[model samples]
Target: MSGVGKSTVLRELGLRGLEVVDTDDPGWIEVVDGEPLWRLPRVTSLLDRPRDRPVVVQGTVANQGALYHRFDAVVLLTAPRAVVLQRIRSRTTNSYGKAPAELARIEQDLRDVEPLLRAGATHVVDTSAPLPEVVLAVERIARGA
Candidate 1:
């Protein structure tokens, strides 16, 4: 999912005046027991407060599932394996999938993890579409459309 256009789309949404949070940003995630997880208190407090508009947050991690009930929509952004790997290789925003091991891990996740995410998703959008279409679809989801 790293290359499925989450950050780019989130930036576009922010430009359009939507509230967006990329939990991959620092201070949002912490490693515990060798796994990266969202900082519970911070995210919980964030969702606890009322807001004029929906806050669309992008993240892919094991522990996030526990908070799904608090969200209005659980969306999974997906792309084909080749597209995902290619985007990962070229992306400048993050260096996650550059290494051989990381790419392999991502490939594994694609096979093992993504399906579970799909099953739980209220909506699933394929990012192989044009960027505008992907962005629009996600924006609509964020807006509760």
Candidate 2:
């Protein structure tokens, strides 16, 4: 999940003129009862608006299942565990996965959280593919091609 190409693909999509929302932003998440959930009102308002182009949203949180139905497609990007760890360790774009504690959490999420996401997902992409190919696949999905 962490090392999957969500951010990378998202950037490419944006450059290609797709509307993209990265929900990892603070405004999109709210903490309630010590659990993180998407701020439903904000998300709903965004999704409700009429749009000329497809909007691709990217994020993962404990309560994302609650908002799955609001999306055109729920896509899960995944890579092998070792690949994820390696990327996490070396990635320069984000510093999240470098810490040992965060790494542990990622390992645990891979086991516990990913399966749930997979089950809820309408589509799954193995991000081990070449980066351009991965970007093209996601672009096709966003373009409804």
Candidate 3:
């Protein structure tokens, strides 16, 4: 799930002139004792903008209870397990799934958290498609198409 192309899609949306907010932005994450804690208030403040156009907020933190309901549409990005592992391993910006213990945690998240999010998703996009296709699909969803 960590490597499901959420960041790529968010970037593409921003390039296409969409207002994008990435909850994983530095200030939103407070690493306490090596564990990253999402600042819900900061995230909520970011989400509390005027809704003239859809604001695409990309992050795994949307699964936290009622926050999922605040969005007009919730798009869940998914990829095959192998693809996810490969992407995580290849990523240079973040060291999330690199260590053995982190990889185990990521695997467990795939098994545990993903299913619940999938069940609640308004739209589920498979990110194994070409980047353009994935971006197009997400754009359509964000536009309520």
lDDT of 3 by residue, 27-93 (tens): 8777667766667787788788666777898776543555876777888899999999999999998
For model 1, name the residue pairs that clash.
none
Q: After superposing candidate 1 on the true structure, give the runs of residues whose Cα lies further than 4 Å from its correct spot.
A: none
The candidate scoring highest on lDDT is 1
In candidate 2, stretches whose alpha carbon ends up further than 4 angstroms from where it belongs are none
- State the local distance difference test value for candidate 2: 0.89
Each candidate's lDDT (Cα)? 0.90, 0.89, 0.85
Score candidate 3 by lDDT.
0.85
- Report lDDT (Cα) of residue 114, candidate 1: 94
Tens-digit per-residue lDDT, 35-132, candidate 1? 99999888899899889987998888788988999899999999999999889988887899888998888999999999999998999999999999
Q: Could you give me the TM-score of model 1 versus the true structure? A: 0.95
